[model samples]
Target: MDKHELAAFLRNRRDRLQPEDVGLTSGPRRRTAGLRREEVAVLAHISTEYYVRLEQGRAPRPSAEVLAGIVGALRLTDAEADHVHLLAGTPLNHTGWHRRDVRPSVLALLERLPQTAGFVMSAAFEVLAWNDLAVALMEDFAARDPEARNLARRAFLTDSPEEGPLYGISDVTEFRQNVVRELRSAVARYPSDPAMTNLIDDLRDGSAEFARLWERNDVQPARMLTKTFRHPIVREITLNCDELHIDDGDQHLVLYSAAKGSPAAESLAFLDALGTESLNSRRR
Candidate 1:
């Protein structure tokens, strides 16, 4: 917790941002290189004097919420937000637990439910483990390069098939926003992990849409929702996506299922049969 480093970092970030960047209009006679201290305070919902004290290295340690507001106001990148938390002596998760392995029990659960498409994802959204049905429904995680297995990276960083169905409906803006919001928390939670850092850096560099959304600083916890996937074979299938959180490991077991007796359920069963047939053929 170096006060000097924190002060300097905050000042630098503030100076790099222009007024227009944060929805403020610069006056005709304005000559400041970036947003004024008062403007930052207003945007961050803090006192002007308190912000000044922060920049002067005289303020007490800021709470997590205050730091989050500042991060949003400054439009800092995920990496930068993590740095601020570190410098403030309030690490996002003090336990320093970043697990890449799925528990055996979790894997067994996936195996037992062959009809369901299930996968385990790290806090950083990396595909740590996935079942065959999951591969048939989504892209094959095993075949992809390790760095490309991230959900955020796949959603924003790369181009999708023009004719193939995507994760959500035709308008995927909301889905994209949700991913960005969740990734923001993930970055803070695993700041020092190389995989998380590299994924963020790549997304920021390769995707303009991603870069724009990242600045919005929207943080949301994971939620259960119904998702529609346009699988090339199954066509349009809507399934309930539920997340089982493994708190100790900071991982999630994402399972996709359709209600019994529904068309979607039938499609899932057909898809599972197809997957099995394909596996038997490869064994020959």
Candidate 2:
């Protein structure tokens, strides 16, 4: 996982940059991630051969300064930039993983607002954990088997298209693009995760649609996206889905709450009724 993560992070970091973004021209047709090897080398003030070696996993180790240059040239985010340094194995003064059993403070604050529903998901798109309000508001997770999660894995599977319907989104193309990008982001973080690699392999081999999208190598940071979903019991509701790139690393907690007494609230009420009915039926 160590070397693999380094490679994945490098791959994702490079693919996300654009020629125009780095003040270069995308004049000619080329097949590669974001910036070409030569372009990135030029930007980072290094030799193209050196950069290629890094990407190909031939370079033994990268210095902090070198990692910084690469991150700067790529215009990576604070999180993405941190990942670059981590991948380089240039340990910073202090580094560690998410603290155990500490629910995101945002979850507590959100719990106070009982009407609002939200859940924090890992960057891997696993429902790392969610709040009760979140379960109540989000249909799929309400009775979700703890074992069944991971947004990317489910997206590529044929048996569980129900998850897509849970999002209530109809545009399969747009959804696939977002899921792929998100998964790529996680891949760099959890390079050894068998589930992540399995999802990629299955998608590539199982569906031609997945193969076509996989080849594009387009990476975009999905932020503050307002998506609409129609729950089975809720009828119709719109949510302002904001993704928080938890400063802690490839971890995130998504908050979904309604804006006052609106259609969303009405929908939530309906959903609650449905959940109650399902629970009661089982008890009987």
Candidate 3:
């Protein structure tokens, strides 16, 4: 079990709750931000000393029944509770390195999409496979080393001194926040995978913003419906964003498309014709 991570998760959850949230009176003398640990132990029907030990990262792995009680006491969301379970090493058949290979069918589908920029992303945000349009619309992932294709690294760590945003996308803040949340989940699901662990360590050490967000312990990222990319050739191209989950591999097929006969559609078609060449020239 990841004692440190489990302890931190529990503390973070506890700090977000008010006493009244669990039907307790906010006594005038109470100075705690959220419900007190003693209060949580009482609600969970566990001894305060034991709960304190858990928070101190000194306790043994909690039983499933005890974890259920703590989950209720902390008022954790479904996602957060699942995360707690993962950190506590509760077996959910979720351990392993995240899948990187794109399915053959998914690869074929990328080639079949007309005027759509489609790509497959692994759980850790590596662009595993892409159509020509995706390369044009985004960057040419084929040219970069496999390690450099990680969107998390691109989002957080910039080689440029000026530190420009990725792809000049309009929602940099939202995108970075989502990246942190997804990586948090990824690390929990594959705690022992060096790829995931090293990536998390690198980002936390390299980027202060990433470190701050990581401490928040946020699991649910807001869903984005549309994305606007500021391409040098097209100026501005907005597309409807659709993320299809490939459950078997825990991968995502992301498609960027524009409405039929619209200006964005025309721009996409133009990019499709220009292909990866235009983007390469711009990079040069």
Candidate 4:
């Protein structure tokens, strides 16, 4: 919670990582472990002094490009990159997406974004309710399978021996990384939420990477995220995300948009079909 604590945590983690851990060749006469400040600077494409400023807490925030570079250089787990965002004060993650009572104005806005996939989420990262198109892209948003369980726990907790996952049973690294990053974005703002604490505990016990990411205590604000998703149903789709705060209520709405003439646009249309199915099933 405290900056000093954050700084210490960052330092401790940097020391724990080995050059080999990040695919760097271990040099002879390496008296200490982990990446040197200079090595991180070289990899991140920034000067050693600037990276030192970040590590020393002299720099209050880093630009998105710099943050990305730091992520690549430090091998900051998704959690760590997220932490950079939080420490930087980009914005609050909450968009009041799950509030039961939302102003008509906000709801109107959410409804108007027909070309984009959108939803309102709680501070808890609960997929309260998403638009027709949004549901199609994020399959989990469409799933009425369970409450209290989100993608993070589902992806990391379920084992191959159990119900089969689309990504196969073998240890999946990238999926784990995405989930960790997603969770890290939420963790920074609402650390005290018991639900989150429990979620992290389950993740820690379930995967080594999850445990490592959690231990770093990186807090990051999720904003304007542009990510690619490989949906089992839709193939690979890339979209730009925008999280908008509902000024009146605690809820917030997030929308994913693709270019007008792109494959992602087609995917958005497919999502509309899926949302119809979801509504129809409920009717039945």
Candidate 5:
């Protein structure tokens, strides 16, 4: 690792951004031109002392995960991310591997589950693919900007809808924490991917809630269980959330199903018809 280059890069990135750019409020009386070292350390989930050491070129070689965190914290672009990886001596070619595709079998499974709300997501919570029912119950992924299709991005970075449909559950705190924890895992797995790093940077800069949750440094296995949603058309429905991990692609097939003959099941059927109509109208 090029210690001098790494230190210079870290300092330069840190000096370019302001607090507001990262969802932090600038104090009434500010002395520094950019973000404080402590702020960067908090965003990167590292100690201020260690970050100081890094900036001074006195620290030991950082692990891939640490490099990833710093990359995200600094809002490094794709090229910059690669440069940081090289400086850390853990370079991995991330070109063309940034986004994973949904398998044909997974698409077939989604097609077969007409009454269920299902979608495929990447480790970074990017919506790779989704069924019509998912659109009916939540915002239309196809209609959103490609970058805006991420669950974590929308949940924390943007304002929650006032009275629209709920995605997983009505308990906002639990949902946000879960998303944050899962994203932490994704950062570790795809440290060299610019897209992942960019997403993290955006989240850290745009959402104080995300920054706070991320600072907890919690890691947990994503759990699949029952969840409640307040759908605008269906009112309220409770469903079982099943997450099938695609080990090869590191993606997840998330399906929500209600018990047969239950009220939620009936609501889901109604939603299917509504979703079909919505799809047909769009084609017109």
Candidate 6:
């Protein structure tokens, strides 16, 4: 178990709750920003001393029942509760690294997707494979060095003013938050992966925004059903986003498509016909 992280997570959650939030009276002269440690302990049915130690990172791994009590006491969201379980429970075996390879069948599937911009993203947010239309809609991933293909890096580390915000997608802030949340879970799952650890460290050290969001201790991502891309070729095109989890490899097949006969659909078809070469030339 990650004792320190669990402690920090609990403390952060505890600090966000008000006394009345838990149906407790805000006694006069209350000085604390949120509920006190003692208040949390009382609500969790644990000793004040124990809860204090848990927050201080000195307590042993909490029992499942104790964790459940704390979860209730903190009023953590479903995602936050899962994060608590992950941090408090015995760590998963870190024997293998997160997979980066796309299954051949999945690669072929990307090619077969008609009128869709399709790509496979690894757990680390690397664009592992892409269809022709994906290249036209997004950047030409094949031309980028493998490290540059990482969406997380593109989300935060892109220093070029010309690059705009990650494919000029309309939801940069939300995307960055989701990236941080997903990476937090990824790092925990792959504690031994230098690549994973290093990637997160780089992001945290390089981007103040990333560091701030990381401290929020969020684990869940808000669902984004559609996305808008401000493409040089087609201008603004909105597409329905469908994410298919390749659980076997811990990858995702992301497809961006529009409803048939929609303006966005016409734009996608035009981009597909133009292809990557034409798109690249236009950018140049």
- TM-score (C-alpha, index-matched) for candidate 6: 0.67
> Each candidate's lDDT (Cα)?
0.77, 0.62, 0.85, 0.61, 0.77, 0.85
The reply for model 6, stretches above 4 Å from the true place, is 1-95
Writing each residue's lDDT as its tens digit, candidate 3 over 1-284 gives 99999999999999998886676899899976998999999877789999999999999998766776677678665577689889998753335456664567889999999999999998888888999999888887888887789889999997694435788789999999999998888888877556788999999999999999999999998898999998778888889999999976688999999999999999999988886886688767
**Stretch of 10 with least lDDT, candidate 5:** 91-100
lDDT of 5 by residue, 22-80 (tens): 65899998787888889989877779999999999899888766776676676666678
True-structure lDDT of candidate 4: 0.61
Q: TM-scores of the models, in the given order?
A: 0.61, 0.55, 0.66, 0.48, 0.62, 0.67
| Residue 235 lDDT, candidate 6, scale 0-100 | 99
lDDT for each residue of candidate 4 in 1-284, tens digit (9 for 90 to 100): 24554466567767876786555787898888787888877766778888787778776565565555555555554456567557665532331112233445666776788688777765444555666666555544554543432546556566654334532313345545645666676555445444566777777887776788767765543344665766556667778867787644345687889888888888877766666676345434
Model 3 clash pairs are none
- What shift in Å separates residue 119 of candidate 3 from its native position after superposition? 0.8
Q: Which has the greatest TM-score?
A: 6
Pairs that collide, model 2: 15-34, 120-253
Error of 2 at 22 (Å): 42
Which has the higher TM-score value, candidate number 1 or candidate number 5? 5
Cα-lDDT of candidate 5? 0.77
What order do candidates take by TM-score, descending? Answer: 6, 3, 5, 1, 2, 4
* Model 5's TM-score against the true structure: 0.62
